[model samples]
Target: MTQTNRVSICHVAVGDLWAGAEVQLKVLLSKLVLRPDLNLSVILFNGGRLSEEIERLGIPVSVFPEDEWGSGKMLFELVRKFQRSDMKIIHTHKYKDTILAAPAAKLCGIPYVVRTVHGLREPFEGLEAFKMSLYESIERTVHRLCVNSIIGVSSQIERRYMAEGAVPRVVCIRNGIDLEKKPIQADRWLTRKELGVDAETCLIGTIGRLTPVKGLSYLLQAVPILLRQRANVRLLIVGDGVIRKDLEAQARDLGIGENVVFLGHREDTLELMQALDIFVLPSLSEGIPMALLEAMAASRAVVASRVGGIPEIVDDGVEGILVEPMDVTRLAESCLRLIDSPETAMKMGEQARKKVVQEFSATAMADRVAGLYKELVTSR
Candidate 1:
C-alpha cells in the first residue's frame, strides 16, 4: 500500500491508569504503527503515563482531559476531529470511551468501529454498583447501534460475549508483550540487596493494583501458613490501589506484617521481576494478565490462580502452578513446593519463558490486529 492509500485509524481510551488494558494498548500501538499500510493516532481522555508513553513512540496523541471538558463537549470535538482527519477506523477501549466515541464514529460514516473487551468488570457495591450497571447498559446499546467488531483478549472472553449476544461480531485475540526486550538481569543481585533480601531468601512477588479483585487478601491469608513452614521467605507486594491500607491491615492482623513488603507502584517492574525467585498472581479474575506474561518472560516460576485467561496461559505443572482463587491452603502449599524444589522451579521457569517467546510476543499480537483491520477495511 502506498502512503497516501494507507488506512487512517484512531484509538480512543481512558488512559490515566497504567493497568492491564492500558499496558496492552500501549504495546499494541507501539507495534501497530510500524505497518506500512496503516496510519495511526490516539485520543485519550486523560493525559498521564499512558499518553506520555504513546507520545514517546512518536505517534500523534490528542488528549481530551475528562476534568477539563464535559462528555457533551468532548463528543462534539471528537466528531469534528474524525471528520477533519478522514479517519477510516475508530478503535476504542473502556466503557466510557466506547459509549462516547462509537456513536460519534458512526455519525461520521467511519468504515469500522471496534472495541476490545479487556476483561470482566471488577465487582462493586451500593451506589457504585448501580452506576456500573447503568454504564454497562448504555455501553451495550452503543455497541448494538454503532460497533462493527468486538475483540476479546482471550477465548473465554470471546465466548462470553458471543453467548451474551452483545455485538454482531466478536473475535478472540490474546494479549502479548514484546519478547525482544528481555528483563534486565545485570542488577538482579543488586536489586535484591536494595530490598534487604539475600540470595538464600525465597523472595515471592506479585504485581498489580492492590484491588479486591486481585485476591491479595487471600495471598495475605496464605502468608501465615507459608511462615509456619519456612522462616526465610519474604513476599513483595508491588503496585498501589484503593485497598492498599486494607491489605496492609490484613497482613498485620494475621501477624505476618514483617514478612510482607508493600513496594507500592514502581516503574522498574521488569528489573524487579528478575530479583524474585517466584512470581505469584492470586487474582479472583483476569484476562491474559501482562504481569504473569512478564514474570514468565523473566524466567521466574509462577504460582497463579486458575481463573479467567490464566489457565489458557499456564498448565498446572508446566509453566506455573495453578490454584483455586480463594484456596489459601493450596496457595501456600504451591509456594512452599517451589521454594523447596529449586531444580523443579528452575525447569518450569525455563519452560514459561519459551512459551511466551513462541506464542505470546507483541509482534504476533500486532500482526493479528493489523490483519483484522485489513479484513474489516476490505469488507467495507
Candidate 2:
C-alpha cells in the first residue's frame, strides 16, 4: 500500500514498565508519533510508571483494567473499544495481549491482526507452571487460528514458535536501540564510590528485573568464585521486582553480599551502563535483550548466556562471550577472562558498539516496522 492508503494502527501491549518490551514499545511509539504517514495508538492492559512517560512524550494511550489472565468483562470491553475505533491493524505484544486482542480484532473485522512474540513461555518450578502451560497452549492455538502475522524478535524465537505449531507467517525483526543519543557518562569514581567501591575496583553490572527467569541466582553463585580470584571485582545490579528479597538473601548466603550492590530501579540506566566495566545477562531464556544492546552500544564488554536471541547479537568470541545458561563456573570464567584482559575486552566493546550503530538504530527499526504495516495493509 502507498503511505496515503495505510490504516491507523492500534498496538495492544501488556503493561507499562521498564522491562525490555516496554522500553521497545516506548521507543517505537515515540518515533511513530512523529510520522505523519502513520496513525498510531497504544493500549495498555494496565498503567503504571511508564504511563506518564508515554503521555509526556505525546503518544496516545488508553488503559483497560482487564488482567491478561482470563476471559471476563475486560475482554468484552476491549472488543467494544476495537469495534468503535477505525483501527485497520491491531498488533498485540506479549502472550496475554495477543490472546485477548486476537478475538477482538477478528470480531471487529480489522483486516490485519498481528502478534509479536517476545519470549517463549516455559514451565515454572511449581504449580504456576501448570496454569501457565494451559494458558500458553490456548494462546498458541489462538495465534494459529486468528492472527494474520506473527513477528519474532529473533530467528531463535521464530523457530521456537514454529516448533510449537503456532506458525503464522513468522518474520524476524531484531530489537533496535538509539545510538545517536549516547549513554550518559557518570564520574566512574563517584558512582562506584557511592556504591562503596574504590577506584581500582572492576565493576560487573547486569540491568534487569530481579526475577527467577533472569537466572540471577546463577549469577550470584558465580560471584564468590570471581571474588576469590580477584578481590577488586564487584557486582552492581540495577532494577527490581518480586524476587529482589530472595536474590538479596541468596547473595548474603553466598558470603559475597558486601561485594554486591543493589541499585534498585533507576531512571538513569544509561549512566549506570557508562559506570560499568562489563555487562552481564544470565537469563536462562530471552528474546534479544535490549539491555545487552544498550550496554554494548555504550562500549561495555558483555558476558551473557547463550540462549534465545542473545547469540544473534553477540557472536561467541567476537563482540562478547557467551556461556551456557546456568553454568556458574563458566559464567564466572567468562567474567574473569574479560577482567584479566582489559585491552581485549575494550576491543570487543568497540566492535559491539559499531555493530549496534550499523544495524540496530531505533530509526532503522521504526522505518522497517512502518514498511511492514504498509505491506500488510496494501495486500488487503
Q: Over 4 Å off in model 1, which ranges? A: none
lDDT by residue (103-170, candidate 1, tens digit) is 98998888899999999777788999999899888888898899989999998989988887868789
Candidate 2 lowest-lDDT run of ten: 65-74
Model 1, residue 116: distance off in Å is: 0.8
The Cα local distance difference test for each model comes to 0.92, 0.85
- What TM-score goes with each of the models? 0.97, 0.94
Q: Identify the leading candidate in terms of lDDT.
A: 1
Runs in model 2 deviating more than 4 A are 1-6, 67-70, 163-167
lDDT of 2 by residue, 158-218 (tens): 7866676655467778888977565575786677666787778899999998888899999
Q: Which pairs in model 1 have colliding backbones? A: none
Model 1, position 261, has a per-residue lDDT of 99
